[model samples]
Target: MSGAGNDAAAPPLAGIRVLDLTRLLPGPVATMQLADMGADVLKIEDPGAGDYARAMGPVRAEVSQFFVAVNRGKRFLRLDLKDQAQREQLLALVDDADVLVESFRPGVMAKLGLGWDVLRRRKPTLVMCAISGYGQDGPFAQLAGHDINYIGYAGMLANNAGPDGTPALPNLQVGDLLGGAQSALQGILAALLAVKMGGPGRFVDISMSDAVLAHNIMPLVAVNNGAEAAPARDLLTGGVPCYNVYRTADARFMAVGALELKFWQLCCDVLQRPDLKARHWQLGQQVGGADALAVKAELDAIFAGRSLAQWTETFAASDCCVTPILTSAEALRHPLFQARRMVSQERHPTEGVYWAVAHPIKFET
Candidate 1:
């Protein structure tokens, strides 16, 4: 029930109008980004329950943190598409809208008489984007899925496993963010550009699972190159000690991303392990082999000798690519984020002053 306004000067999408008939994370996030860049996004919700996210996550005075976090910088409207009056009203709005975004299972909008076929016929120049678990007209198009299911089906989860060989449950919704929201955003922008160039507006079908599968480029490349491409076998996926996470003395973790030879050499010098410099990934040592494991163990022990604070101090001025793994709270207070203004102070009707995560898109005049 709350909204945040953007005050930026002459945003690129200043005249764009977006009708967002999406409920949860994916579609809302896409429209939020559009709104942040000066699109007049009208978030259309069902009259009964509105967005299901309104009751999800932590709530203060019945306002869901999850909903508030992503629903900023847009206007809200409640309409019942099933009703004749509301449907007519929506059609009127569509006659003037530049874009329409939806995130329903396949056939839901078609059943409601608001499908792309109908909308495109009504306004040929309007870009319509449908975000779903699977794309339209696929065998699994109507299947219900979430982020975990999509990533798991895409084989992304298996590649990102813990030390115990179990797939780690990522806190960040990789499939939702990258596959759904970002994919939809890219398609919408492309379609908008096409419309600007006098090309017909297109229907953008964003399948989260398909997007994740397409985004699995590294593994795909490995498979194409006739490599095993198994879990933990790739050079970027815990196969080498240079690009990995190490536990520090205080139980905190430090991320090591010294992927290049020079950075790896600097890291070895920082850890006083010049002997291990020759064991770099490009030196023909088998990735995920005994040698790599042994070097990783040695680096682990060296990193465990120092706390995260000490390691931070040691590599503060070095380009060794070693950094402390920060908690969400620590990340909010970090100087790098503070300098970028990633979070901003905002006021809610009931919660008063609260923090809002700012959109990362920085536009220049």
Candidate 2:
């Protein structure tokens, strides 16, 4: 909806055709990015249920808000893959599609007679991307998993914890969004580029677990150095005072990311605790050590002495990477997003006006 007309102003993917046979969050979001970039995305669903997300969450007007959020700017069609006639119809669509994205279990497509081999043989230039929990051929290929399961298996859950050492559930679906959607998008773009360069079409295999594991970098570094990555104790976690979260007087939280020595020094000066500047990580103070904990406790007490508003005003002019933890509603009204044009309102046929997030990437003509 953002960029659909005028050849000069059309988005980069204007002429590309994408056949999306995915459902739920990850795959739909992936294709939604394509739709945002002006790809002609056609979403195919089974005749019986279509996308399960249509009934998964709160219904606004007649359709699910979850479905409408990720399924914008796409043409929809229903065809039961089990039916021979419907399967053939899908193939006909595929013949003209530049990219095909699916998120079924590894062998399900083959069982439905629409596997990558069949597709590639039919159209050698087609880029096929398959997103699964594990991978196409792996021990856990047949296993069922959600975002939590994938992140847990990748050791990400263990590292994400609080002072109590209990793994906190994040509202963001890391595995589904990062591992599935982002990984699939990266592969699809790369494959499309390869095809455009006159190379044979590539089959993109996206394993959510694999992607999660690959990105768990900091922990892997510790493991490679022959040390265990303790929960809630890593440098980037809550181990140090320079980069941690503190509670304010009103029970609100503030995120402190003054990782650099200069920023830490400035933060200490703002807190009127210049004495604490010497006890920094760069000054050879061991992270998560007793001294670090003591410093964190002192800063925690200081932060709790003031309300969030008082602290915000106190650090208004400082550039120490300190910020108040804002809720989603607050973020929507924040000046940063408003100035960036990251949020917009669209009127659905029946749902009236709904807020939508614009694609983050920007291109200058």
* Highest-scoring model, TM-score: 2
Where does candidate 1 have its weakest 10-residue lDDT segment?
1-10
Global lDDT of model 2: 0.92
User: What is candidate 1's TM-score against the reference?
Assistant: 0.95
Q: How many residue pairs clash in each candidate?
A: 0, 0
Q: Write the per-residue lDDT of candidate 2 for residues 1-365, one digit (tens) a residue.
A: 33334436768899999999999999999999999898999999988878999988888777798999899989999999999999999999989999999999989999999998899999999999999999899799999999999999999998888867799998999999999999999999999999999999999999999999999999999899899656777799978899999999999999999999999999999999999999989999888898999999999999999999999988989999999999888888789998888887789998788888888887555
lDDT of 1 at 90: 97
Pairs clashing within candidate 2: none
lDDT of 1 by residue, 1-365 (tens): 11234444577888999999997899999999999888999999998889999989777876688888888988989999999899989999999999999998888888999988899899999999999997887799878889999999998898888656689889989899999999999999999999999999899999999999999988788778887445675788888999988999999999999998999999999888899999988887788888988999998899999899999999998988988999988888888988787876788987567778777877654
